[model samples]
Target: MNATGAWDRLEPKLAATNARVAALESDPSRRNSFVAYTMERDSAYCDLDGERLLMMSGYSYLGLAGDERVVAAAKAAVDVYGTGNHGVRALAGTIPLHEELEAEVARFAGRERALVFGSGYAANVGTVGALVGQGDTVLIDKYDHASIVDGCRLSGATVTRFRHNDVDHLERRLKAAAPTGVRLVIVDSVYSMDGDIAPLPELREVCDRYDALLMVDEAHALGVIGKTGGGIEEHFDHKVRVDVKLGTLSKAIPSMGGWIAGSHDLIGHLRYAARPFLFSAALGPAQTGAALESLRILRREPERVTHTQTQAQRLRTRLNDAGISTMDSTTAVLPVIAGSDDAAYDYATACRKAGVIGLPVVTPAVPNDLARLRIAVTARHTAADIDFAAEAFLTAAAQTGLI
Candidate 1:
């Protein structure tokens, strides 16, 4: 039964996705998703499929993806420490670079200490499972990252999801929960799809009232917000307390791995207790070195954060002014609503044909009627580039009959 009946039972569940993929792949102009980059010209542009399209879908928000300094650090680390570590970090995997990277992350995030994980997904799942169990309660945003949702499911904690960005709904749920075990409220600092920010101050006030610990994932917020790219704290210029702060290194840091920053005691507990950290091999030296260097650059040149946000608004405005709905985005990410799954595919196909590479987010990632093209504008995209991308998007919308 295990061998013969597995796919037979599972294939039906995938029929819709299969059809969507078939339609998506049928387009001759579609080439963005899952394509390997042969070369990167800079932070703003990459060479793919024998063409150099303007990139509107990358996560290097601070323009440091191919910075000479970052590349140099990664190369130097490989020369000294070689390619990989010996074992799991608990045993022989830890390196000087790992310790140095953690310290720098803690410093940059204004936390007492930091613990690094093999990946951001690991950080969330492992930390959540380590922190809570039966009888504990966890509340999360409806639109948080999938990793966060998986973390809650695996934690053995009773999970409650509140409406997206509604603090009042959260308060009501908190009031109704049993007042015995730990209550943790988690959210993303900057929502990945909608690109709106979490109301940190409001969340802190509500969490404090309920004695609930607050956690915020900075995956999309770290390099896109803040005055000096200081993340949620800087974005609001408010001294809100976030008990558990976790984020990924792959996005703005332009490297691999992840880190959880918090009080020294929390870091100490997670270092020894988190299963993902305990079981997985340590982060590679090159990734650690690259992240460290990128962070240093972010510290020295915060204006890049401002530039990225400005260009994002510039693009958002252009699209909105053209009567296209961007749907509540106010950060470097702009969600260009495309109506439905088929419409999203058509929009992306038309978009690629016009020499821009913005990808689509269709159901069930988003509601069917709200399917969209998620365009993330990074730093180093000049005003001209932003204008060009905007016009290209408008043209695609027209071609797809979405306007």
Candidate 2:
């Protein structure tokens, strides 16, 4: 077909999608619903549309994003390494900083070796695709992150999803898979939306019984769980036999990139086989330096982890006392159910008007009935800040008729 004819055929579908988006964005009640707000400062509290709002939906759990030491490290690295690394790691992009960061990550994760990726999504996608393929069976939680779902699809593996956090459902699926091929079970250590933790010890037993390899994504758990922010294994107070550990530096680390930590042989194989690791440009020197400093800070100051968890508990208690529903949240993430998409958006808008920034998570990201304001608590939030946020939430709920 001619170029003009092809354009004519494809234009309608694209226009229809754009029209739907415009309808949602232009609605008076839902305006500014899912739009990103420009942050004038760090995430603790940010200026949005000329109004300063206390950040309640950010993921920098330990408040390391604006830490002077971390920023200084990043600045020093920029001074020495310039801006970009210029090539993929396998070629000329590999630097001493990369090796140093990898070693520190492996040590932090309690693994023999670690491999870094350009981003957490790349880490999951590349690791899963590199480890398993056609004829292999990959089992994942129904509520796993999108990157994990994409990884499973890309691997060409026989993918099956068990019910969310239901070990019995997982066991049933494991029993049905073929006995000859590689059997892998993957789950998030802490579900991002629900804020509930995975039953890691129970899952370890199930994997052992089925002779399956277990992988846990610690994207939200690291620097927020465990005694010293060591992640799921540390949180459980027992070293669960997790075969593969995957996490992102963007959250608690307050930097870019992701990592997969495991046996030396496994990491070595991924270094050559993982497409994302091999083809993607390396993580910037500034990010690596910042992450390294953050990790060190986390180790030296374990109080940050404890303080974050304590504050999360306080927020949940305040919400519950005010008769607001915080569904299944036990970690720094708190979801206040708002019933419907419009209600969730309305609640978030109300919170914003009350001097807090809590984002609404609507349908497609969550179930229709589970739409909520995803509030995130961090170490940076003081007791007074928590109290103020709780008061604002209660007032917003009352104003929106959500209480």
Candidate 3:
């Protein structure tokens, strides 16, 4: 049982990361996805060590991060709850705020019940692992979130990944699999990096044909799509049936947590069986309160979603007209394609110098050849801001030959 040999080999893996860090530090202009910025008055710009840059890589799609109401709600929760609860949800940590937030999420998501976890990562991993195991099979999109991939790997279920958003390929994988205990098909309703909407109707039809349960992660869909920003179902006019609808409270909601909404039975099972939810401490009162208020504001103000989509499309058209590819993006998230990793870095640096902050997305998040700037738009963006960013992107791409 001696592990000295195995421990010795771990140094090489750590050394590789150190090498990458050294490479990045050698060039101050090269970004590595970990930039810090202070967002104050304007959602259109963020301050970096006193330097103001036009923001684009943020996930606050609804532009509610600095809302006075959301901040007041969090402060109120802190005053009442005294920061945190006593224990985990299975015990004393079950605060009234948790129940209220769950109810609001369930109602908003068009489900009968809901459960909250400390983070979106916990929700995905906990739910998927608890729902299927042993004899079950989980078929996921190749481009599903890392948390989903981790959940599948840890579920003790046979896992298979089909081509990304390829319904026919999913059908082929399902047909080729053994008839088993549970067949769960999971996909992101809107892809994070590609910024494209999943073919939900087609996926549902295929899952129905194969008698599989379909789970759609609406992480990037909510607050960015549909007439009312009600997510995938609303985007598709309530036509398709997704057995499980789960999403992060952190993204557009501007809070901190993850949730799944479904029938009462499904939620009930998760409450008792999901280890991360049962064992981990419940979501903090401030985050729960903030999330609740943000959801309410989004519900009341659907026009924000419209403005976000409009600005995104306007920018996309500009990029396209300038001979730059945005891939197939149709949402607030836009991927400005830069041919190589170095080119993406250059594009980001140039864009920043030009006053827009579209950070480069490198390998593993997207294919190496497809490295891009994962620009995100918010409702707060003005026509002038959009024009400025478009001009920056075009000029940067031209200067670097990134097109």
Candidate 4:
């Protein structure tokens, strides 16, 4: 055995994954099904390899990604602010646009203040690591996004996982292993992979009883929930809830970055101590400007939210009626559980062949046993598009023996 001989040991695992990829690439029907590349947008759909594929994998829940107003705002900011923020926020990155965006987000979420980060992953890891420490107990949902889980681990907190959306399990854990100092209970407003909503009301009640601070990552719920699109707290009509609310500007706001909406003190603390925010360069002028415009649009055009939910429900209904399994998703995301990883990839390929573009969620992003074909419904998708995708999925699933 030589120094490079160790590489031979990885052959088995690599071979397995390579075999899966090979199978996906081998099938002609699946080969042209889903393409991984960019396309030129013309009207509602895009031109992909000369075929107009109905894009169903976009996360622009409010369909503001290509809004003229947003584009103009971003461009104008680029011309005026001249691109980058130029430094870390603590140094020279903080600008008027960042301040304004933070203020707008905090107001939208009904919080006293907000702190902005380069991305949602940054916000979670930074806030979690900053707030909770070695002695604290962080209770996380099993199905929470990877960022939340990573944040807990990075915080050096004693992390305990609870069953997804199981309030009883949460309460039991809280009672049995309550933190001697600070207890941070974290969950996603909507489970990103499954599209199922967390039991916010129950969770909030439990947190109150345990005297724990509640944190919610509303990445999927932001643009798709609440009367004002404030996310799960608003969707469940929880008054004065969520000690910390995390939102992503990229999804609903049609720009980039993440924000934490909370008390003035919390925001102030993270501004000074959060590792990512302190060390990372702040969002550039264009993103900040576009996000501000998107936020304004969301506030003014509340109909976007209504349209998104209606569209999601319609698509979910159509998919279910087509004999395809759509998990218990109440939001814009719909996942087709494919018993195994290969099956999930096959389903994704089928959707692509049918002119529907979706993503495959497989291990370790999702549990190996819970691999799924993830579909995101946008407000821009029409009844015709939904019908086409539903029919295509039906045909592909039947052909692939997925159903």
Candidate 5:
């Protein structure tokens, strides 16, 4: 098509999107949807239109984002390495901090080696594409992160999904695709939206029976689920034979990269074959240094994990006592289902008005009926903070008729 023809086709779609966004913004209840908020301090709180609100929707599970030691490490890295690495990792971008960070991550994950990527999305896309091809297959949990779904699609492989955490459904799919070439199963150790854990042991068993590789994304689980902040394997009190362990540094580690940890051979292969790792700029020195220090902190202060989980449990109990549905959550993340998109938005706005900042997760991020207020608890949150947040949430639910 010529330029004019292309514009003709694109203009209508762009207009339609604009109209949709305008409609959403015009509603008073939806006015706060996707509004940009400035963090006056750290991830625990932010300023929205001059109002400070306690944050309850962030992914900084360990509360290390603004820790003094982590900040000092990052500043020191900036002083030594300057601001950025000028080349892709494969050529000249690799630095001492990068290697050190990868080593620390691998050790923490109990893997032989680990390779870092510019972003968690890049890591997933690069890993999946490098592992499977046209003739290969990938089976993922229906509720896995969008990055995982995109990675599977980018791999040029046959992609199938099983019901969320339903091992029987997964086994049926595996049985149907038995004896396949390069069959891989992917799941999140903790589901992000629902804050529930995967059935890792059962999934591992089925994968072993089918001779398939099992990959677990530990993005939300690493510092929130396990006894020593070691993720799902530690949560279960046993290693579950995960073939690939994937995670992001920005969440619990409070940095800006992702990693894939596994056997030496697997990391070695990805180092050579993963396009995103090879072509993208390396993770910056500040993030690497900060992540390294944050990992150390997690190791030294295991009680942070306990504190976060305990606070989350207390919040869940409070909400449930108020007749609010927390929807299978057993971790730091909690979802208060609102049954409709409008209701979810209204509840979030009411919570913000009541001094908390829980965000709404609506269709098609979730099913239409399962729209919710997604709340995340951090180690920095005290019992009083939990109580305040719970009260705010209950008040909002009542005001919005969500309970």
Candidate 6:
């Protein structure tokens, strides 16, 4: 059948969803504030048609997205190692650069060993699947990343969810599962959407009491928290030996890839057993080189990490002062709750219309009543730029009757 015909068959179901979105758009509290367009971007702002607005929609929390140093390193690696690894990592793709990047990530994360993967999703899937199996139990935060949930599913393990950041609920669930199977608790160090932090130390203590191995995904935490950018484990000053520390290089590292930092034995096992590692191409030379360079910069310039947190706090405080809902965040991610999916999308569009590109997160990314404008602050934002963003958001919210 033709693509049109295939789509026609599914249109009814999709139209129902569209109707709900449209209804939300018509809401008096959101109608006046919506954007619809393509945007051209610069270093810290994007041009929405003819208007220039501060850019606040990126995961480039360190403003290293297009840094000259990282770019030059990538180009040099391309010249030296070409564009692709050309084979799976176990084959002819394993290069010296990959080894170097892995070592740097492992050291930076304060772990004895690390294994690089194709992406953060790949790391979670491969590692979690490898570590657990059928009959084992995996306890995850309700707001955990989708990748972690999929990982649990692929592992053939029974999955259970506790309330978001609720240590009591986590403990209750963990204790309930203790007598049944091998237990694993996985949580994001800093939740990607809600902008709230996980109570990692409390969770760790609960896990210890139940003999469950604790896993922490710092895809949004690394490079933005901890004294050395080690993430929530470092942020809370809790030194619980995280059995698995998963992170992504695409964010703060300003590169593309992921890593699992853990004990040497565990990493070595993933090297041999993880299907993603065995089947996926090795990290490209340019990506590996750029990530390595970024890691070096992170270690050498700890100020960059501190600056990101300070910027986040500054922006969060400003938004709060302006009567904008920041959703209890204390990290680089600041969420402006819009209450409904349509409202969230409209608010994001309105921000774009005002010249800022802000990301609107809605279900199934977040629960249905918690749709929000997920803004990731970076050290690259100046005080003036922050003020501009805050004012624009407040204006947009007021115009839409959101505030």
CA lDDT, every model vs. true structure: 0.89, 0.90, 0.89, 0.84, 0.89, 0.84
lDDT of 2: 0.90
lDDT (10s digit) by residue, model 2, range 155-221? 9999999999999999999999988789999999988998999999999999999999999999999
The alpha-carbon lDDT assigned to residue 180 of candidate 3 equals 68
lDDT of 4 by residue, 74-135 (tens): 99999989988779988887889999998899888888999889999999999999999888
Native-structure RMSD, model 3 = 1.9
Q: How big is the positional error of residue 304 in model 5, measured in Å on the Cα after superposition? A: 1.1
Candidate 4 lDDT: 0.84
TM-score of 5: 0.96
Residue 54 Cα positional deviation in candidate 1, in Å, after optimal superposition: 0.5
**Model 5 poorest 10 in a row by lDDT:** 23-32
Per-residue CA lDDT of model 1 for 1-403, tens digit only, reads 5666887878887896777677766755664457776537464666766888888888888888888899999999999999999999999999999999999999988999999999999999999988988999999999988888998999899999999999999999999988899999999999998999999999999999999999999999988888888889888885776899998999888898889999999999998889999999999989989999999898899899999988988998899899998888888989988887777878888888888888988877886688889999888699999998999999988888878
Q: Which pairs of residues have clashing backbones in candidate 1?
A: none
Q: Which stretches of candidate 1 lie over 4 Å from their true place?
A: 5-7, 10-17
List candidate 5 segments past 4 Å from native.
27-29, 40-43
Candidate 5: clashing residue pairs, number: 0
lDDT of 1: 0.89
| Highest-TM-score candidate | 3
Colliding pairs, model 6: 35-349, 53-355
RMSD of each: 1.7, 1.9, 1.9, 2.7, 1.8, 3.4
lDDT against true structure, model 5: 0.89
lDDT of 6 at 179: 80
Q: Which stretches of candidate 4 lie over 4 Å from their true place?
A: 1-36, 39-44
Cα-lDDT of candidate 6: 0.84
Instruction: Kindly state the number of residue pairs that clash in model 4.
Output: 2
Please give the TM-score that candidate 2 achieves against the real structure. 0.96
